[model samples]
Target: MDIFTGPKLRDFKNSPPHLQFNKYVLTGYRPISTYRDCLQSLFYLHNEFGNIYTHGIPFICFLLVLPLSIPWAEIEWWIGVVHYLACLSPTICSVFYHLFMNHEGGAPIYDTLLCFDMFGVCLVNTLGALPIVHITLLCYPSSRLVATLAYLLLSGYGVHCAVSAQSNVHRLQSFAWQAIFRFFLFMLRLTGAGRGSPASLRLYLTMDTLALLGGLVNISRLPERFSPGRFDYWFNSHQIMHIMVVLSIVYLHWGTLEDLTWLKGYHCPGE
Candidate 1:
């Protein structure tokens, strides 16, 4: 409850250089802090407070609440496991990255956290779609195996590019291959070459759309670009991106659940 009586906040000009990525966010920056001080900042009002809580609350909710909705016993065990991890990974890693980004360790710590955050995104991209691939190519075991392996290879490349990326645009670009491959899967579903819950394709499309939009908005730094300093503490491009990312995850969950339910009764042409 209101930890440390609100440490004095700084402006963009005074913030650590690493935290100055968004020049439009002209105020409400937290100073470089010790580990304990960073934790204490959680209770105080700062620009990052919105970023931390936006993903932090969802991480807690997903960790506790999503499992209850998952049919862990009904589906292929691995599908359930991957889906659970995919749903939880991004937000938890994001919470950590945002929460301690300004630690006294400075850029090295920040870079490590950024990589950790990218790894979480990588996990979701890699793990989340194993089920979709498994279900889509269910009728063709050989094709399913090849597609799954291909996607894994692509995701590995993406992870390398993302963690090593020097800018936000490059980080967003790193996931392009995986997204394109997913688009191919969606096309298969649309053409009836791949099979899933018919409803799922739409949800999956929406999921990707939201994610792409979020990345573009973040890269463009919109609204904030239009009015600097106005959204320093909330509703800025990054916060908006965070909200969109959460919604995209929800869509992914809904789509996967649809596919799983459809899987319960469907079979290959001869099996």
Candidate 2:
């Protein structure tokens, strides 16, 4: 078959059993494909098409645009690099996972890609907040050290749970501790007990809200659930979640930028 013309698509029931997680998506499944064939699927219309591009296009845009906006020379070396990686990690992993999910390697490959995709999410949750922690505790070095270590330990647990999760709910639950930790930090900022840009707290909150909503929508399978087969090609819950995740990352970037700018001019009462 010509790569451009693409292979004949299958229905959800006829697709590989592992890929049938969404029963509502009744059509437009790509058959088990080779590496080249999977790449070619990018050009054709199918159920996974929106999933691939929603994150794929953002991955390209973020890769090219994020660095230019980061103040690398003005900030701590690790902060700038870690934030950039955090911003890029989820989208790129998602792109690859959605793109190659139908590879001939089958279920095992799909599982591995799923884990990789989960790890990308874990990376953002882990790395994205390091700066927040650093700034929130700027006035207390000892507390900052302890909090940073504690968060990393909690994040390790979150990563393990996320990759091993059997359901979307479980995957969403895996991040609860991290979210709670962030909430505590946000509380400190809100109460003026911790340090950070006042504006950033709201952005971070919005980011988390969108991410949570995305997970809930994916698990609930809304819209598609309401009208099965209607969303087999576009605006399915997964694609909606992908777009939400991208927006969440954008808010993360905006919040981090606000904090970073605040960090440049602000200092502790004594130092």
Candidate 3:
């Protein structure tokens, strides 16, 4: 019997090699299979140098929002949902931008996608900050004007950051700039500058300025830039920036929580 004409031979030839050899073996050949490939590819050096960091944002944001779901009588469930959604948006946008923006012949599309990612970050950050400020003010009527003004200014600054960031090619650099803006605001708060108390405000400002400077130092990537690839997988500037961002968000959240707690002790205007 000629093998060429054999039914078994024909079937064998038609079958994929992996399947023919071992049907139980799962070979991921689909487009979505590339996710596993990406995981494996992490160990290797390729164009996806900063891809992990790009994808990690959403994961971290999810973790950040998770705790907010914990029981808090004053915090409406709807508000938690909104906060979660807002926090997740930037991460989702960032992941998509990183995943597809590097496709061949897609530079313009990449730029547009990245712009959306930046905008998402700005919008989400602004959204997250506003609700907290509003809720805080609702608790502390005496601080209503200050909180409202702060919220408006921060929102405006966020919009400015988004626009400026879109115009810049270096996304990380743009993030650093935004961090500086936030640090300035944080400094003002620390100094009691919003309440018109010079002495107390100065002391607070000093502390905030120090924190901001530390954040800047981490974000600037000075030592790493001086020696390319030296701190690639470990303590690079971008990594430091991410850490600082997480810290800043945590601090802001805690501050809001504290304010809310204090407000709960007081009667709003006339109880």
Candidate 4:
């Protein structure tokens, strides 16, 4: 019988207690349907908990491969090191956050853990821009001042975002917004705006601002929260937020490729 048909429901009700109990136990250990619920579910043993642990392996592998493919001078090895460290920061913090965040007795420790989680987000966001900024500045020496300042600002924001006493929902929203803003700013540069030029920098700042706003709107889940559980598995606000983040990263990488192409057309610093 089709699982969705009425007969299935009738059969399920009439099934023997032993079989029903076994099925219920198996299903009970499965993951929760929502993002927030998944975080909460981490404290207990479940099939999804292991899946989540395995999710970071690919990212870690990519980080390892990055250095092998690109020479240090071409992309600056130290910057890649910083970016790699930053990327891992958030993942590590998240593991700990989910593991122990539910202990109600240690309010102070929980608060500290939340701070670390925020720090991780900020680190990942700022670090994402480092390699791009470094290459662009190298390609266009005139923009060094502007690039440095932008880097400082981005790095500072990451630190602030990490340490701030904000709720997880708010932090996640902020991260999504920042990633989106970075995406548009990069688009402007890829179109031929001079590095660190006033117009380009203004566009970049505007992009970041827009991203912050977007993050807030997404995390709050305003319209959907009005009807809970309706968008649990699909078409929900968080999924939109994740899509935006992935898009932003793609845009950043594209902008970097454009910078590399531009550099290839010109002679290197001493040549």
- The CA lDDT at 33 in model 4 is 27
Give me the displacement of residue 97 in model 1, in angstroms: 0.4
Q: Which of 1 and 3 is the better model by lDDT?
A: 1
Which is superior by lDDT, 2 or 3? 2
- Per-residue lDDT for 1-271 in model 1, tens only? 3485677789999888988999999999888889888899888889999999999998898999888888887888899899999999999999999999999999999999999999998998889989999988888889999999999999999999999999999999999999999999999999999999999999999999999999999999988999999999999999999999999899999999999888888878877
Ranking by lDDT: 2, 1, 4, 3
Write down the TM-score for model 3. Answer: 0.56
Highest-lDDT candidate: 2
**Which has the greatest TM-score?**
2
- lDDT at 115, model 1: 100
lDDT of 4 by residue, 1-271 (tens): 2222211111323433322321222222321123344355545443224333432443464456544533346654576576556445555665555344434434565567667756765766777666556544555666655765766675676566547735546455445544554564465456755242333344344435544544565656744466554443344453444334334433333343444444445554576
Candidate 4 local accuracy as lDDT?
A: 0.48
TM-score preference between candidates 1 and 4, better one: 1
For model 3, the superposed segments whose C-alpha errors exceed 4 Å read 1-69, 139-157, 164-219
For model 1, the local distance difference test gives: 0.92
TM-score of each: 0.98, 0.99, 0.56, 0.55
Q: How far is each candidate from the true structure, as Cα RMSD in Å?
A: 1.2, 0.7, 12.4, 10.4
Residue range with the least summed lDDT across 10 consecutive positions in model 3: 24-33
Off by over 4 Å in 4: 1-74, 139-142, 165-191, 195-218, 222-271
Compose the digit string of candidate 2's lDDT tens values, residues 1-271: 8867788999987889899999999999999999989999988888999999999999999999999999998899999999999999999999899999999999999999999999999999999999999999999999999999999999999999999999889999999999999999999999999999999999999999999999999999988999999999999999999999999999999999999999899879977
Deviation (Å) of 114 in candidate 3: 2.0
